[model samples]
Each structure stands twice: as structure tokens, then as C-alpha cells.
Target: MKKSVFLACLVCFVSVLQAQNFPILGKVVDSTSGQALSKASVFCQNTTFGTITNNEGLFYMNLPNGGYDLVISYTGYEKKLLRISNTQPQKDTLLFVLAPQDNSMAEVAVVASNEVADGWNKYGKFFSDNFIGTTPNAAHCTILNPEALRFFYTKKRNRLRVTAKEDITIINNALGYSIRYQLDSFSYDYNTKISQFTGYPLFEEMDTTEDVKKTWVSNRAKTYLGSRLHFMRSMYDSIITDEGFTVEKMNDDPKSTKGSNIENLYDSSFYFVDSSGVSVGWDGRYRIGYRKVLPDKKFLQEFRLPANASVQVTLLDIADGFVIEQNGYFYEQYDVINSGYWAWKKLAELLPYNYEYE
Candidate 1:
């Protein structure tokens, strides 16, 4: 099997209020026939905001003012994604034009490869470990629609690829959320021990008992603290130190592990905050250290580090920099590569973009 693909995605902006909620209208239509596509799924990626198009192909959603990737999907059609920066009330209806999917080409390109008939049984654990994650929260997570998955292995490349026939359902009992994931692609390289997956996931808070809800609240708060999401939000609010995070510039040499303390995270040289948002164009790698929470035991063991490891640290490489909004959303997301602890925090630990710690 010869299979490969890649993707990049999100954005940010803010004003007086971090993000003001406003109504947005949109329509979806077939590009070839110019006909309205009814019942099409329209959503803002990584957020709970979503709606289905009506008979006339119209839909509306009230999204907080910020940057988002508007996702449009319908059966047997090529999915469309639009980067939207909604800072003001939209007066005009947004439009989405999608083309029919080439199932034949996609099949020949991806499916016709050396597919494993018992893929789920063979690679199910591997896939789930990498996709849903291996965090403590992930232990209680279940892939509700495992049957939708199709796995392929390319012997030549020592790579495994997984795709889904439809949205994959995931129930995160630990976080008390149900996730509908539109899986575009998931690939893993055995040689590099690298796994990458791309998709638009819509999160919905699950109904539960009051006791469970309280437990979920506590869990979410613990997960959010010292997280990359927390760091980004602190950066936007110009409260890095207040949030108990420290920034350091990594040594120039790739082999060197030493770094220098970044006394001023909001220094004009690498960062700035304004009414619009925060702009950070850090030239080199940054080491973010958070002592508010200790490193996960699994992370400590996985890295073969001492049990005394205190700080939860992450390494970041920014390509040409990126901008962040008050909601902790960032843009040129592809340019920001995460390593270390942050890389280990996958979907199971992810919170909705609209998540508010307070």
C-alpha cells in the first residue's frame, strides 16, 4: 500500500471583550449543479457551535467573535473548510460551495492498497492509543464507531494509514463529552515513531448526574492547568507569570539541552499584545515550564526520566510566528510544531476552543 497525505489548520482576534457572541448566517450548494444542499452539516471546528442546512441550504449559528475554521460536510462530497475571522457582526450570508467526492480515485489511491481485512482487531489498539491518546483520561474513552474505520499498511514505507467511512464517535467518560470526529486521515510511521491525524471534531457536553458533573468540572480544571491551552490564554492576557508559566529560549545547537530564562515573555522583541490580539514571532525554539503541575507519570516513564521530574515542560518551534486570540485560539497553526509533554496531550485531553477555565 502506498498512502500519504497532510493538512494544516485555525486563527485569532479580540477587541474590548475577549470574544463577543454574534449571529452568523451561511449557505451550502453543489458546485456542479448550483443546487442547494439540504441537511448539510455546518460547524466551527473544535467548537460546540454547529447547525445543519435547511431545505434551502441555509444555516445559522451564533459564534463568539474570534477566529475559526468553518467546516462544511455532506455525504458523497468533498468537505470544505474556510478560515473565518469573525470580529464583527456579519451582515452578509456566508457561502460554501462543495464539489462531489471522487470515490473511485480515492479508493484507488487509498483503499486499493494492502488493506487489512481484520484491521480493527490487528491495529485497533495501536490506532486508538495514538489517536484518542494514552493519557489517564483516555482510559475511560471509547470509540463508539470503530466499525467505520478502515486500516491499511504499506510494507515498503513501514507506515500504517487509517480512514473512516463516516464520522467516528467517541465518548469521553472522564471529561463528560461526546465527540463526533470527521476523520480526514490518520497516519503513523513505525520508523520515526510519529503519528499524525487530521480532522474536524465537534464536542458536545454529555448529560450526567449532578455528582458526575461536579467531578467533570474538577477534572476539566485539573486538565486545563499548565496546559498549552492555558499557556496560550495567559500569553493573550499578558499574564504568563501570573499563570505560573516560565518561558526560556532553547540553545541554538540541536544537541544542546540548555536554555536561558526569558525574563520578559511579553517583551517587544518576541511578543506584543493589543486590542486585536497577541502577536508572537519568536525566532527560535521555546521551552515552556510549568511547575503548577507535576509531569505525568506516563510521560516520565516514557521518557525514562527520574521520578523526581517536577515541571511539566514543552518545546515549541514557531515557523514565521503566529497570532493568538483571547479564547486561546491561534493561527498559522501548521507553523507551530509541538514536542515533549504537549505532544503527548492528544485528543482525549483536548478541550473545546470555546472552553473557559473560569
Candidate 2:
């Protein structure tokens, strides 16, 4: 059987906005021997905030007051993820014990093929487009190690599956961050034209000058707005209109005889939260439309979608109500499936879990 290990280290700190900045302290060591593992990469997933473990296998990072999915990675060991909550009180130095990877698991090949090389050669561009996204910032993102990637195509399903032999390093020059991603699963269905990848990423801020820092700050804010995170926050706050979102719920129940009139089905009565009060945990579908249209020249040229067009999107299989904490941390109870405009936004548009509006 394939063996995978998981460990978590949660550290909550108040942000500068709250008048105090706290440091998250932790140590990484071997599970069996309790030996320190130095040079381990530690960071909040998707955010450009992280630091490496020192010689003592210790690390300290200052994170803003919010919830984050912290990731710790090292060579020859299984990656670990910790969900840190800002609401929790700061604790003593957290200890993470990592188990060694079983060598036998590496020897077993899930997909045997020489087609791996040919696949990357044939579908490299398509993979990059869907994975890194077509956003303006995507142009600055480069996959540093593409050779470690392996691919397999399923004819019946018309889907592509990809895996990596090791961690994939991506340099986001536009965002001034280096992302080290350990890909667990990846697939793209040709029939649906939808792609998805599950992985753990550790983001490291790139060394930059003061001027470039300003650019990143501006760019990050731009990317944050109109994002899924922003939408969720707006929904939780009951301020959809203020956030430029026109959310209308759709009846997905096949048994419900709501008639064939699509326009009538889009009535505001079906809104996620109406006079019935906010839906605590809705397990249904909804149409999320954004009025903010992208007018950036780079976006227009890259996507080639009509100029100044409204962004209309649909989300399916949402199993729960949009729940958000005071610190802008969204719980992952809703397994939302994004389609249309939002579907195109990928890692390139992803903000850190701890990201908060200024």
C-alpha cells in the first residue's frame, strides 16, 4: 500500500493592523529519532510569507491576524500541513515530527508509459495555460522544473492525468514569490474542458527593491478583488451588492418542477440569502455573476474574450453555506465547482489564505 504521512503546526498571531505582530515559532524533527531536520521549507500555502528552518530545525515567521494553511516540506520526507487560526492564543514552540518516505512507494509506477515525454511535448502549453492560468500575472510565472512531470491520457474519458516525481518549483516574477509545489493529483477532462490539481505549495517572497515591492502590493490587491475569496467574504458579510456581485440561486433539484423558463428561475427570490435569512449551510447550486469587467489591456489580449464584458459564473455542488470567520478565513465546507469566467482563474490568481483587504 502507498504510504503518506501528515503533521500539522498551528500558530496564530495578531496582525499589525491590530497593533501587535506576533511570530509563529516551530521546530521540525524526525518522528522516530527526534533528530532536527534543517533547511526545511516552511511557509503559508499560496502566500509569499515563509522562512526556512535554521540549523536547529527551527523557524519563525510573522503572519497577519488570519487563518492560514501552513505547509512544511523537506527532501526525503512527506509534506505536512497545519491550519493556523488567528483566534487561538499563541502557544509554545510547536514540534512537527515527519516520517520518512517509503522507498517502495517510489518504485511503484501508477502509470507506465514512454508517452510521458511525448505527452509533455504535445500538451505542455495547454497544461501550463490551465495550471498557471491566463491572467496577466501568468506571463511572469514559469515552471522551473517541467521534466519531473509525467502525463497519461485516458481515451474513454478524454481526460489527461499528470503527476510529478518531485516538487515543482515555480517563480512568479509578477507577484515576487517562489512557489514550491508538491503535486498530489492533477487531471483535465477534455469533454468538460475543466482542469484541476491538488497539491501543497510553500510560497517564498522573492528578494525585491522598494519600487518592486510597491508593484507587488498593488498587483496583489488587484488580484484579491473579484476573487473567490473576496466573493465568499462578501457573501458572509451579507454585502453582495456593495461588492459588485449579483448572486442568484438556481434550482438544481431534478425533482422540483420549477418550469422550463430559465429567466424566471433566475429571480432574486432564489438568492442564496433572501428574506428567509442567511443560509447557514446550503448544499445546492447558485449563479454568481460579477459586474466588474476586466478592462486591463493585458487581460483583453491574453483571453481574447469580448472587451469590457461582464463576468458571469456558475458554481455547482456547493455542499455548504458560505462560512467565513471574522479574520476573513473561509472554512472549506463548501466544495464549490467554478465554471465560466471564474474557472479560468487558477494558481496565478490565488492569494494566500491569510490575505485580508486593507
Candidate 3:
């Protein structure tokens, strides 16, 4: 998914409030040898649910009721993601097979010849701003392993691409968490001025004092309000108005802000709800405006917008439609793309699927 694109089965919205326990008993193995891969990392992307395989390549995790991209990773092997949900038919156990990293394929795809020798130095800040974000919380976040990242520039296309050899460790001091991100794909298009970074992130809570925890809670609360997760949860519970969100339809012109109000978000033509997942979309581009709070001044300053900007607005378009789950986890997620605000809140402001939402 690009910035104005997900088309994102690399979703960012996460978590559940009151939910049931769903168990995932899993095993990871080398696809070629059929040998168990011990110590393999098993995690639900964007959530606190994660663990490592035992000597037998077996791992177990209990998830709060919702959707998740279950990520499995081992060094020297390719990463795997299984889109899962609690509402689907329950399975007592699951198996994952990972192939060895194909360096030949990597070379062909990454175009070794076009590699930027001084990539990190040249594109570090740019990648950080676009992927990790430029928000206040982002300032406290740090990528610990720039060495694992590779960069490529396609001058003809005026695009930048970045990939990683291993899971990148990111320390988020502002939110009191350490993030392990398995970047799948990240590309930025100069002409469109859009960037997309798709990755599976596993979050681990940092050891900190109660004072710091309190600050984290406050920061998390601030981050959650008016967020994509908030919006999806609101739609799932049919509380769009109560949550202080306003939806306006935008015309075909991406630049045009003109549109009409959507009195019902669950209109039968554009949406359908069920126990599995909720189908959500609109005819064209739609503007989601958050009225409960003012736009973060830092965001305005980062984007160099007027100081008078008030509402937090997100412009999005869904190709056909996508299925959104209870915790805001959606699939065929890449079908949806957001431009303005939500895309601006990247990895730093992200929270997990099991976050305690008070």
C-alpha cells in the first residue's frame, strides 16, 4: 500500500477493549528441510501478542477477540504473515513453513547494480519522516538497526525503495515500548508525493516506572482519539456520531474538498456487517473529519500548514471495499488508502491489537 494507498493488507489500526481469549498454538519449520525452526519469532502484527518457538518449534499465544496478521520470522528465512480472526472457525493449532531467503531473487528485485552506496546517509531522514512519522511521539522513537536496511533509487521513475535484511529494532521511549518491525515493502513516489511502508510490527512493553506508565497511558489516549482504529470501532458499534466524527463525500477530483454528508455510514449499498467482518467503503473518495479535538500543532508545523487548521481530516478511497474486523483490523486492507492525517500517524503512534483501551 502506498501512502494514499494500502491496496494495505499492511494495516495499522489495532486492538480490542472487552474481548474473549483466542488461542493460537503454532509451529514453524524450514520449508525445504521440513526441519523445525526453534526460537523463531511468532507474533500478531501491531499487537502485544508475541512469543518465540520452543526447542520443538512450537509457540503459543492468546489473542483478544479481533483480527490480526500473525507474523512468523526466523533469521536466514523469509517472513510469513497469516491474516487471522477470532470469529472465524477456531483452530487448535497452526503450522507455518518459511523458505530460505532467496538472495538471487533479492538481487534481481532490488537491482544490486542500482543500489545506493550511501543510502542510509542519503535517505535516512526521509525514510524516518515518511515511515516512522514526524509526530511528537516519533521524536522519541529510534531505529536501532539502520545497517540492516538497503536502499535503491530508480531515477527514471523518481522513486525510492527500501528493504531490510532482518527485523529492525525500534525503541519508542515516548510510548514506553520497543517495536520489532519486519519491513516487507517501502516505496516513495516523487511525482505523486506519496509513500507507502508495509511491515509487520511486534510491540514489547518497556520496563518503566509507574510515572512513566502514566505518561504512556496519557500519550496513548491522545494518540487513539480520532484515529483510524477509533473510526473503525465506531463504525462497528454504530457510534460514528457519538464519537464526534463527521463523514463527507468527496468528488472524483482528488483536490476538490466539496461533497455531501453521509447520514448513514452503514448504508446497505456501501457497507455490510456480520460476525466475521464488516464490509466498508464509499463510491469515491471520502473525507473523515475528527471534530472532538483540534489537529496536533506539531502535525500542522510538520506539514507546514496554517496555524488556524483545526479539525483532524483524513482523505481516503477504497478500491472496491474491504472487510474491517472488530479491532479495526481489515483485510484486502491494501484496497484502502488514506492521505491526510491517518497516513501521517505512522509507526511511532501505532498501538497493538490488545492494548488496554480504557
The models' CA-based lDDT, in order, is 0.87, 0.71, 0.85
lDDT string for model 2 (1-358, tens) is 1232222111222223443445689999998899999999898775667788999999998776556778888888878888776556778898889998776755564534324557778888888998888778898899998998988887877889888888899888887778888798889999987788898777776888999988988888888777777876676576767787765556777455232223442235433443222334645666676666454555555668676665645354576544455445555732666665566678887776656566
When sorted by TM-score, best at the front, the candidate numbers are: 1, 3, 2
lDDT by residue for model 3 (1-358), tens: 2654653323432223224657789889999999999999888889888889999999988777889988888888878888888888877778899999877876686664477989999999999998999999999999999999988899999999999877899999988899988888899999998898888888999988899999988888888899988888888788998999999988888777798889778788878887887877554688899999999998898789999988999988878777878888777777788888998899888988677666
TM per model? Answer: 0.92, 0.75, 0.89
Against the hidden true structure, what lDDT does model 2 obtain?
0.71
Q: What range of 10 consecutive residues in model 1 has the weakest lDDT sum?
A: 1-10
Instruction: Show pairs that collide, candidate 1.
Output: none
Ranking by lDDT: 1, 3, 2
Itemize residue pairs with steric clashes in candidate 2: 281-321, 282-321
Worst 10 residues of 2 by lDDT: 5-14
Superposition error at 306 for model 1 (Å) = 1.0
TM-score of 1: 0.92
Q: What is the C-alpha RMSD of each candidate to the true structure, in Å?
A: 10.2, 10.0, 9.6
lDDT by residue (1-358, candidate 1, tens digit) is: 1232222111233333335766678889999998999999999888888889999999988777667888999999999998776653456898889999887877678655989999999999999999988899989899998999999999999999999999999999998889999998999999999999899999999998999999999898988999888888888888898889998899988778899998777779878776567899786788999988899999898889999999998999877888898678888888989899989989999998888775
Clashing pairs in 3: 6-334, 7-334, 7-335, 8-333, 8-334, 9-333, 9-334, 15-353
Off-target runs (Cα >4 Å) in candidate 3 are 1-19, 108-111
Question: Of the candidates shown, which would achieve the greatest lDDT relative to the real structure?
Answer: 1
